[model samples]
Target: MYRTWRFATGCNDACAIDDYRDICPVFFFGGIHSKKGFFMGIVRKPSVTPPSSRSPVDATPSRTRPGSATFGDGPAVKIFRPDTDQAQVEVPRQSAAADSMITVSSMPSAQILPMHPMAGSLARYSLRAPANLPAANALGLRVFKSRNYVDIAPGEIVLVRETGTAGEYRAALVSELVALGPVLFYHPLSKTWTLERPHPLPEPGKVIDIDIDQLVRKVRKEHAQKHRVHTGNDDSFEYSAAQEGALVARGLKQFPPEQAAIIRSELQAVESIFADAGHAIGQNYKDADAVYESFFGVDHHAVAQRFADSVARGQALSSEYQGTWGDEKFVGVDADSNSAAWMYKRDFHGRFFINRKYMQRGVLSISLGHEMLHTNRIDRFQTIGPNAADYFYLDSRLGRLLNWDTLADYDVPERSVSDAIMRGGLTVEYLNAFTNDHDNFLFGVSDYLGIGDDLPLQTAVDLFNANPSLRAHLAVNNADSLVYAAKSMQTLHQSKTEYAWLDSLIDD
Candidate 1:
């Protein structure tokens, strides 16, 4: 079926489609929620497939825009084209032999209005998902990739709302982070896009008139000015790699003088491992391999071989990890979000779970940190070497993460559940810091690296690297503080949930 939509006079936007190939959400029969009132009609979600080689999924609108709707409701939405005063389009129908044939022979030409200052600018950015019906869908666009996401910081857009030569809306952004209004509406008086909450009442002509080309150029100019420093740190970053290494090397020789020493003490705290398998085999897996290979000269093959050997010797138990962190958010949107200690639990939980996703691996993975909090049998803590998290923690920095002024800090590991991740980022950083060959062997020895609960090992590795990468990316635009603040101010689990163990890993 063919359809055409025309903008009313004083408006210049125009779109018409030759083919209405049905898939989903796009060009489908659905109801639309409008400020004026709910209506059903013959409407469509249309876009030109990639001009060149991109696949259909790639061509699909990467992000949901302001007027985008699910396109599935009580009945097919009739053709709609916003006019200067009314936000409606009429479809004509004529009855014939019990079957009605509807056709509109004429479409009024959309008047060519003077272009706005921000027209054709594909300069793009992102907006946080609002608490609206379509908000969940904001995550589905290919850009999120769900886990392997880059900086969600402002200027880093996953996808742009392009003027697909078909849609009435044309929006995109470039590199520079400039004026962005997720809820932008056209200001008839100013003739420029403004960052204001769109009015609730039905005032169609006075609302947003996005120019994809304009935004594209604007963002580029803005991002160019921001990227000068290179390092994600805007305050002038100067770090001595040598100094960081020397700090760890200094403590290399220290050990508790006891049979049940720091390492053994940690091993004694064994909890069941919760290994989660993931669909991703992308940068996350590559990063883990890279981090391990660069520092310790170890790769996936070696790790796999060792796990095999450990299994052959009965030293390691293989099991699949479970759970999905997708539906999971840093903060709950419902009454749960209203909890008295919402911020603390939500913030830390997101980071903890995110880092866990970073650490995910193919084989049996565990939370080495969580297993260290509760040791059921004192006699069982003697094992070390491959397939044991204890070996990794024996002389490594991971031990530093399990600290407490009071003995209550002992329970932090046990609290590393799905809903709450405790000190997860710190744990990952400590593990990553142990990238030295000696440190790697000390911490990365276990096949079934003991993580009793929450995200599997690979997940942690992914999030661990993901954050720093994101931080660095945002440092370009000075939004690093926004990301950091969100990641920080979080508790081990809940707000009342204090760190249950010692504050330092170095035993006195």
Candidate 2:
């Protein structure tokens, strides 16, 4: 009993092989004569570790919980104790076989963050359980059972990658290993997948609380604008179901009914989300806002209020909307603005919102630059309100919002016949101007709405093609340079911009 080491709990026996027990269990070693018969090695004399050789594991008391840095079927994590900053323990991976050689390392557990602290977005998406069990298994995590492939408990995290054949970039879900301590992940810089402690999502600290109040001020500035037309000049523009139908009828004819139905449902959903307030998502926004909200649970109204407030302030103050950046202006990185660390699950949450395959902020801003030129779009053709002070304010508003980052001090392109191609023709001026005219007409809806013969052309693809430099920033394999899927956000302004209206007016 003198050689036997007991825990602080007082069990007085060292651990034995074949002991499948919880933490704080006794562990001791001996040779030749031990009963329960673990470690049948070649009989050498006196190889047992003596009492003076008590390892740290033997000295420490048991502190096991599900969240304990070391657990099962995973790595032995070297954890930083919550109470102190000191590095405390390294629980080695246990083996059931007594003779099995155990390989131990000093790696810590991985940090599992579905909502990243830095990125103001949900980085990892939780897959719908059991329904996606096989998909989860395909990414290499042994999450499914043998008999029916039932999903394991505890939600699984997945990274989205594009996997379809060339030209058609579809999203594919891959398994991501997340843990409380350092775990394995594919590190982008080194070009190797290695064991790394994942970045834990931080709490929504003081920085964000301050930023939210600042943004609220910005939104208030937006609420004072005169250019918005949704509810104004309204007796003539009450919501019209017939007008909405005629607007998309021809475009609808091109798509299969099933596909068209989904678009219509999404559009109606947009109307539901935005129509009541003067902020109704007009044709310019289309199904983009709805799809964006569905994909990331983004509060469109909140973001829009910010953008609108900024636009209003820009229109009223200077000649255009300007970003809240630069000397005394730089708003800092988007991720650090309001971590709502509680909200983002991954590191690249904001990246997806600013740039994605669907209608993303980049494409919309580019299109806005062109659309702002038409008096109908900017002035709202109202009998009640007056025209804007100048086109400079409109261009600058968009530039501050999307451009100045790229097409420096650029002019908003002048409207012309060629402008018909901009945003697949989904300009609000056109929508509001012709709603009464086209209420009964079903023809030319595709060209009129600015969508291609292939329904509404994927805006991201168009922007992606324009900005070839975007291919490298995303951490996914690009399908011939167009982003099918990516993990990081490349600045939209970094790409070369081609203004359709500018070219048209120049040609004329």
Candidate 3:
């Protein structure tokens, strides 16, 4: 007998191939092991009416219980604790209910499987038993005798049909395990297939009965769907792209008019950064935010709120260097930079802390876009693949929540992967352009230096893409370049005619 309790606890144990008994229990059917040799047996035939508190072996309609459904060939299984003989079963009766049921079969004690000694020795190691066994058994929610398992977690969205609703399917959220069986709660959502919720769902309440088989089927179908790139259906791609564009637009609209306009003007520049990054991985983007959502979901409001909250909390911290990083401004590295240990402190509790000063500089959307793109994405890592050297390198950074390291011990493939991610090479280029823009006080002198805003950034990206040991000195610290510009301007100031021409250029 497979111990299904591990599924409920989310145990992470590995079994050696030789120990078949120690293999983790597969979460096939709900509650009881789908395999034979159950402590007590119940064979249930499909029934429409609600089950009542009745004996497992001889379950017949009891007139005392009004509106009780008869279990013709089916018998009720008693739910019992190992220390007790049996417990009172409470099978709620409903006039129109899609009552779920559990099925188990009797087996000799000698045939019952024993738990692994190590696992059994743990404290409070209760035997796998559902709290709502009586209801589950009556409702015909039992594991199928099969070699398959589908593990569903609480708070996950699932497709479920309500009891007595004539097979009307809607999205339901898995609440918890009652009697070691799944309990689903109905939500008001019409389309429940996605995990993304535009707004928060109300707390899990409103218990509902559902077909476990149908739930498993929905999970299996969606699991398959997640792996395949949606093709031959321009509708899905078009819808997703349009939805993402609207989400970004909405995010932009939330800002003040002047600030929003500044952000809007920078959208094309920001989109170019993402487009160039996507080109590295052969991904074509119709909309920058669409590609962004493909990595992060279409939940812009939540991420923005989270960013705001992080900034607020970070400001509350007692640190002198709370939001001051002059180096970051020089090199287009945002607070998401992983260049030095000091920069790590800018992130409080996995979120970047932005100083209000930065926002007032009209780079609020730019910073938001940078942080949002840096958000962890499992799909992105999967696309990088395990065999790829950059996979482990990228994993180390993302797992550490460092986003991207501008001066990370650079490598060819690592640079490729980094360039493809918004936080990587794209960050270097975009930040330089934004920081050195004529309107930005910080680093704006770069635009006046004759050397283009992106020249240093491009050189850094190219160096990292080719040489592993090369540090991003030029990109990370443009102090020398700034010095050159200052001295050159000072020299021009000494020449009357030259200074007049240079002063005219500044006015222009």
Candidate 4:
């Protein structure tokens, strides 16, 4: 089972392998330290286990320049040296055998190239992932709790490339490096990392050479392509200034001027929300403007426009069933009441559905504002919470089935009493309830903007303060109010509450 192989010149004498078995992707000079330690031969999926502290390789360090070995185009493999962290080593491409036994040998004197610290740092920042795959499948790397992460922090920059393509790249702004794998990045115009796209580390020697000009060119190209689509030949797709005025006029023709004005103000406020969030994050507005407009661009379903027109004409119920908003969008109204408004990206949907029955300015503003977030594709991200406990709660058996329907009833007196006595409070349950209803995630944000000033949220908060009996109802029924109140309590009392994580969720 042992075969002696001569490593190409420049390899350290330690790399002389007398036996090789199941060594793949990369090779390890030192064998396993103990039976409990895993072998490098096993190509791992993300989140399987943490990197072992015990030395799996020899304690002696080696150095090599950051370049491909003469044998093949593949990048050099890194070996772990016990004395130093991530000692650099290279292997001849053809010498990498996955089925041969590997026996460690003594080091022989050879030329040791000096490591480029800056170049190595940049290489670590580079990421690569499979291209043109679903978000879930694309990020197959262990991210929850692995140690494969780069040194880059959240809000830092990194160069990324997709697998199966060469020379194409994206300059990403990292939102987070979750656990240890699948890097999450923010869109230039996004308020939060709700639209986070995860990327895996590059396969050896595949680190991207950062080029500022190339990245700028790619962004500009995206802007141009989006602009072309927006102003393209399809006249029906137009959402021009004329269309905006006409859409407003139709609403005014149907409702009283005062009511219509309020609706108009709400729509404007929604735009302001989108604008402010992007600006606060230092978004590239020149490029982002096109991306934002394309959210309502010509490709929008004609039925969506017709539905809006019908609502404006006071023919909501009788309006030709808005057919479908197509595969990319989800459009619906709250069946129970206008009091309950929610919106988020889940499958997909377009065009906000207005409940014509409740035309009050305050009610309409909240509903419209909430749905508008969805329509504009600016909804909240899906995650249980920021803490380990919250993530565990979400990954639990109950979290998977949690929807608005599966949720505990807001007004259940007996359950409230039991929960209070046993659990102290319902903070965690209520905090995590926004999974199905993303609009509730930003309720505190909307409150800050005065979107639902006259709604039950404020009243619910007052009730929560005044009576213990009322707390349970407000906690579940006025769930959004609870978020707002959480923010208020933290701000006024400077308390470290469960909802402090909401600061990461809010747009500003």
The lDDT leader among the candidates is: 4
Query: Candidate 2, residue 442: CA error in Å?
Result: 20
The C-alpha TM-scores of every prediction are 0.16, 0.16, 0.18, 0.21
Cα lDDT tens digits for candidate 1, 1-508: 1111112332211112221121100111111100000011112223222112212232122221224322221122111111112111122233565344444344332122233233322223232222111221332222322211111222221223323243222222222121111323333333333334334444777776676667997886588468522211211111111111111111102211331132223222211111111101111233333222221222223332232222211111111011122112211111111011001110111111111111112110122222211111121122121211111221111234433222112222222210011122234433332221121121121213443223444554444333433222211111111111111112212221242244243343
lDDT of 3 by residue, 176-224 (tens): 1112112232223432122222344445695456666679979866974
lDDT of candidates 1 onward, in order: 0.22, 0.22, 0.24, 0.25
Q: RMSD for each model, in Å, please? A: 31.4, 35.8, 33.4, 30.2
Error of 1 at 370 (Å): 15
Candidate 4 local lDDT, 38-98, one digit each (tens)? 1111122221122222122332222121243211321222111111122211221224463
Residue 268 local lDDT, model 1: 22
Output the better candidate (2/4) by lDDT: 4
Distance from true position, residue 401, model 2, in Å? 31
Which regions in candidate 1 have their CA more than 4 angstroms from the true location? 1-183, 200-508
- Candidate 1 achieves a global lDDT of 0.22
User: Ten-residue segment with the worst summed lDDT in candidate 4?
Assistant: 383-392
How are the candidates ranked when ordered by TM-score, highest leading? 4, 3, 1, 2
How many angstroms is residue 346 displaced in model 3 relative to the true structure, after the best TM-score fit? 5.4
Better of 2 and 3 by lDDT: 3
lDDT value, residue 408 of candidate 2:
22
Q: Which stretches of candidate 2 lie over 4 Å from their true place?
A: 1-120, 127-154, 159-161, 164-508
Ranking by lDDT: 4, 3, 2, 1
Which structure among the candidates has the greatest TM-score? 4
